[model samples]
Target: MKFTKETRNAGRGRRDLLSVAGAALATGLAGCSGALERDGDGNGNENEDGNDGDSDSGSDGDSTDAAELRETLAAADPYRMHQYGPSHVGNAGGAGPTSDVDAVWTFREGADDSHYEIGTPAVVDGTVYVPENHSVGDDGAETVVYALDGATGEIEWEWTYPRGTAFGSTVVAEGAVVLGLGGSVVALEADAGTERWRLERDFSDAVTVADGTVYAINTTYADPPTLVAIDLETGRERWTEPLADERMFWPTPPAVADGTVYQGGVELTALSTADGERLWSKDFGNAVTGPPTVTDDACYVPLGDGTVAALESDGTLRWRQSVERGGRGSGLHPVSSPAVADGTLYVTSAWRLTALDADDGAQRWTTETAGDRPPVVADGVVYASGLNVMEAYDGAEGDRLWRYETDASSSSGDKVAPVVGETAFFPSAGLHALRGADATSD
Candidate 1:
């Protein structure tokens, strides 16, 4: 069904039913971290208003149990549509790969030849899921999604779709792997590489699955694009809403938290997760270049003007921070989504990674980095990818920990932010697995 601006609230009955289901699923699948400590410190205590603190901080009276937190971290899905849940915060919850890491294994597709390209991989429950594109014959290309063992870098199973292209990263949800292929969305059993369901449509961007529903944007670079909702299990269309006529140069997928879906395009729009009702809309006057990162209290959007704007849950503007990039115009501004952890917001712009206080938008620290992909935070380290190198920084102090060179070229155009689990996975020309230097002895 199509929803327009006037009839947006037509499906109140169905939306009310979905609201209950969405709430329950959200509580269960919500990322472990949300609030930043009120004192602007990395403490794990709640404030006077009952806002919880950072999960990584060891403060007194924190509700998250240590053992439970560890289990969640161990099973963390690193690339769940922009690194750890629909918020795109890039916070990995528990400890990430340490500074002392060595390449454990490198999996190169079609190593004998040179036509294969692997997209950014998703990690969940000790497995790395990746979609690969390679030439099938002379004129056709094939896309295959492969599940690799996270520890040994071995392929467990692979599902191939002939004569298609998978443009974005893979998402693991509900014990299945979902991705967009050409104009369709396909789900595969995460373990056995069996096809669960496939929905035929025009989805040109990555898919975000949360609260038992999958959110996608069906755009063909034409007017009147659509925001669609599909059943996470059956691949059935729940609702479809027409977006504004503004064309998007890049795909800004929707991020979900607390029963609300935040999407970025010509403007930042908030819609109900239950149905496609337009709750609110805000125009930043500049193109929103990346998907928003949602927390308990605020949603963060990265704009093309080197500014990160934070909004309250009701779509009110909280604060906006502009990172000065010498004299370069907005065109050169980094499009990386902001990553929040330990009460700090980490964003990359103008070849630098800047950390800001999540509460007041105060600048905490800034360090030089390369590339435009969002940084991932785990344990106490921040992982960022630059032209051809992936570097880790001290999460608390913003100190350079170590760097790993992925290719010899200075500008490899590799934008894969390292995904950390038991091991750190980096995707460039191929996938490289690294472990802590001390892991060998242990």
Candidate 2:
């Protein structure tokens, strides 16, 4: 129940809007609340491999019909912990290899009224661009986004977005910091904290940038949800595609790969990355709350009701796997996004953590953590948090390597996400870092 504080608080008041921190793609409204920490750059690069870690390139396979694509994405990978993609491993070569000494640097909160909560952190050059929620008053009002030293957590510069309510994560690419608030998306100068351009729209969705354009969706309870692609430089709308049904309040961020942008609503939808044309759409079962993992010819969707599905790149369901069949109680629900590492997918449901084969959807291993926070895979290890504990697990196998406990209350079940670099970062009673046994190995 530790990670559920924010949602619980919001649930007690008004459950329509929740305020999420580091993971950025948080549901609900902002207030004095708890948040999940997040790593930036989805599947960017891992230091252990010598492969060229280009963010845009992926292995290609022969294209199939949209129906087959949906089936392929649904089949479930036997080797991965997530299907959407890997949680960020931090900026390329920023921190040395994970080691002992457990080094952790934190920025002091801006003011009593301003508590520091992070969105996804982006490490570029030597700087970690963090989107921070600085609470302005007791009403949950705040200014968001900050640029900091990745290694030291020192504040380099900061800025605010217009009409920005603290929600969703910052998307940093090509020297620009981008994020979405209650109804608009804005791009800022990553270095000087200057505003480049802003897209005004009624949406709280995070913007995915690729091919010099931004992809955003508006699906709050107030309006019909539509996915919109916009030019990053000029803030011009490229194309807009409406959803199948009018269901609102989606927390899943858009995943972009190859020439397509993959996302899910009440159902799964794939759109052409270039023209915003609809490529495919599939109904999994329940709505989707996280990003869909994409392969050259396949896509994976982790459904809200605890089903892991695989689909072809064109949107056909291949197979499905459920975590509850493993004798775990159905009370564990997956709201946080899953992380993929080394062909294995990691997912968190309420109080349970699971790893599955990316190719088969077979349960490789399952373990109970302190709370149900999403796991971050790095250096062959998974970093997860629960209740009041932070834990590390063998990424290849579900073996407990180490555990760290804190007096800080664990995050609410509805809001658990972790970020990993050379070290993994978690926010509990305070902030926590998990490093490897060695300190000097880069």
lDDT of 2 by residue, 142-174 (tens): 445676544444467888753225455456666
lDDT of each: 0.63, 0.51
Task: Single out the weakest 10-residue window by summed lDDT for candidate 1.
Answer: 1-10
The candidate scoring highest on TM-score is 1
Give model 2's TM-score versus the native structure.
0.72
TM-score, candidate 1, is: 0.78
Model 1 regions more than 4 Å off: 1-79, 109-115, 164-166, 246-249, 326-331, 408-418
* Displacement of the residue 358 alpha carbon in candidate 2, Å: 1.4
